[model samples]
Target: MRIEKEVSPEYEIPAVLQHIEARGRRPVLIFENVRNLNGTRSGLPVVINLFGARERLADALGTTVARLPLDYVAREKPLAPVVVDRAAAPVKQVVRTGADADLYELPVLTHHEMDLGPYLTSPSVWVRDLETGWTNCGILRVYVSGPRQMVVNFNIARHTFHYFQKYKAAKRDVPIVLVMGHHPAFYLGAQTKLLADEPHIIGGVMGEPLELAPSETWGSDIMVPAAADIVVEAEMSHSQLEIEGPFGEYTQYYGGQKLSPVAQVRAITRRKDAMYLDIMPGRADHLLLDAPMVEAYLYNRLKDVVPGVTAVHMPVSGTARLHAYIQMRKTNDGEPRTAIASALSSDYRLKHVVVVDEDVNIFDDAQVLWAIATRSQWDRDLLVLPGMMGTTLDPSADDILTAKGGIDATRPIDPHQFAMKLCIPEAVLSRVRLEDYLTPEGLRRL
Candidate 1:
């Protein structure tokens, strides 16, 4: 929905989005009349909350929400990108360099109340690995410090940081491109856990080869998405590290100031009519992008050890990283402990795992919690491993090490071995339709 009312990039835009979120609506928002940082009306519209809904994300993969995780795992084959010339690239239509390429002209937004300042939340920063020559893509937070300078957090554990370390060792500045405003599938593909040429993985997720074009600064050596709405070509300094954040992160908390590499913007290219895309931090749009990939990876890993594993869900309550709920058909009493051990060791970021019977819905939090409460005693079923590697972003973590815990919330394999769960008869459920029992207006109210 396009809002014709005028808004500022400072706090107004994000405040409006927060209000919308409170009402439990995640519609794509277009701020048509937005004031840029320089207090000038922006020609380009700002797009927010594009990835807020699972149904839309599923649509991007050409699958249903229920099958999204499995579908993603099934389509992991790499497909090379097809390179196109500058003339054929939509993102190259309007190129600005030197003094004309001003970052202040764009409608960058400040998301949370305590956020440092306006940030570019959705750019997929691309850098080539020094040894392998593979292009690594990371959706990192960028703090726009000046008209031509920005600070990027090259996380030490991520592929970008690993490549950055090599560049630093060689004493060479890293050439990078911040790709913005591409299709949802493009971003989803970039979030794959597989350590490979990301464009190939992106193409496989897109179900075809992605189009690439020579970057304005590095030419053929560093190709970027040909159809991207906006591209910022820059060089990250190997020596210069700047203080970066106190910015709101995906964990629904502020990430304190830290030293990061400063990127000097060389050029800005975009379509004549482009949309500035922003991912609402600490919300569904920011978290859901990684959900499918994480769920798929965990599910595949669990299935290898336990064939009876039915599904896996990374709940939003855990920021889609720290926790997982696994559902399986248990064959023996020891299966739960085996699954718990395998799952906790599967991913470093996973701090908690809850294994339940197949009959319980893994997607529903209440059902999973209920199973935990009734199924087993804490002394026997609770699994805790201290001093495990975890994400540094986790506020609860002791730096990067955390205590991982799990609960085997499954009942006895035999139906009569444990107390039975209450359920309405299938005959009654099939016969008593809500539509038939209630008035049309009553149904609408419900």
Candidate 2:
């Protein structure tokens, strides 16, 4: 989570990529003097790829990448956020209202060729439920539309969309706060799907309780992270809507233009020198950021039905959302099939699920594929569910309904005829060190 600040005279998307390449693919980069669309320098700095690398993400969570899901599940309880005085909040150092509330001044990036315009790629939106008064936060996409207006797209199934629906029914503007640049834990927490608890509680579980500050325009009930680099206090118009996309998504495809809710900015608050965070669409950072949360959710759900469930992996190849791999210890013959069905049901976005024994490493794509090749019988082990509700982002789906399938890659439980994988003896393998016999060049080649 350590960021390297660059004192560049000008900032652009290409320059950010160049900086990443120069640093040999470093995770985080903070750029000062970000250039606007007119090629004029802006006062605000921009932070990109903050959670790009797995090692950096692991460091942020205080655990190794392999242990992130288990750790997250263990600490997935609600811890109330602490409200701090506006005078003590770093984000309240400078307040821009009325004429100064201009979204164009920030360095929003046009990430792809077909993008509609510059987009705020890393804003975690905060909204309150109209019926329950419970606060909800989600990392949703925002397209910059004007000086004080932006289009916020929400999936119909997401909780944020549900809250917006309530406001739409009541015919009132839904107050919202767009939080940018806080701890990586906050970003990960925003993606978590909690039924009872709020998202900010995940931050408290990870490290400390998130410090809250009342939004200047949205009243005291609408809270934002006090330590955030930037906060956009806005309200979503219940009746007014606009066409918002053709922007790149995590699925590596352009989400076609659609009418989305518009949020008109009432105020913009930030520190004297704020860092605006941006995430690249359809990239590793976008995928892995939500992967651990999804895995933890599936693990929690599956453990209740299948007691032997051990691990869940949503590989990056599946965009870390649409495909799943479940590893479990099979006590009976029907367990693998049940696990496969349960996995597909657990996440509606999942189109393909593969259940394997604990012996296979789900993280390794090759090993999982190998298990399917050797352990699965196409006719007997495959289960297909047709005309199921699928993700809207899936290009192949017809009207968001598609046929999904699962593969039970676990070996037969009766005879146990699968051949054992050959490996060198543990004692001998542990004793051998390349430095003892090989040259540096030879070791590198090996």
Instruction: Superpose all Cα atoms of candidate 1 onto the true structure and report the RMSD in Å to 1 decimal.
Output: 1.5
lDDT of 1 by residue, 125-200 (tens): 9999999999888898899999999999867778999999999999999999999999899999888778999999
After TM-score superposition, what is the CA distance of residue 412 in candidate 1 from its true location, in Å?
1.0
Error of 1 at 284 (Å): 1.2
What are the lDDT figures for the candidates, one per model?
0.90, 0.82
Per-model clash counts, in order, read 0, 0
Candidate 2, after superposition: displacement of residue 37 in Å? 3.7
- TM-scores for all predictions: 0.96, 0.91
**Candidate 1 weakest lDDT stretch, 10 residues:** 152-161
lDDT of 2 by residue, 319-398 (tens): 99989999998899798888888888878899999999988999999999999999999899999999998888899999
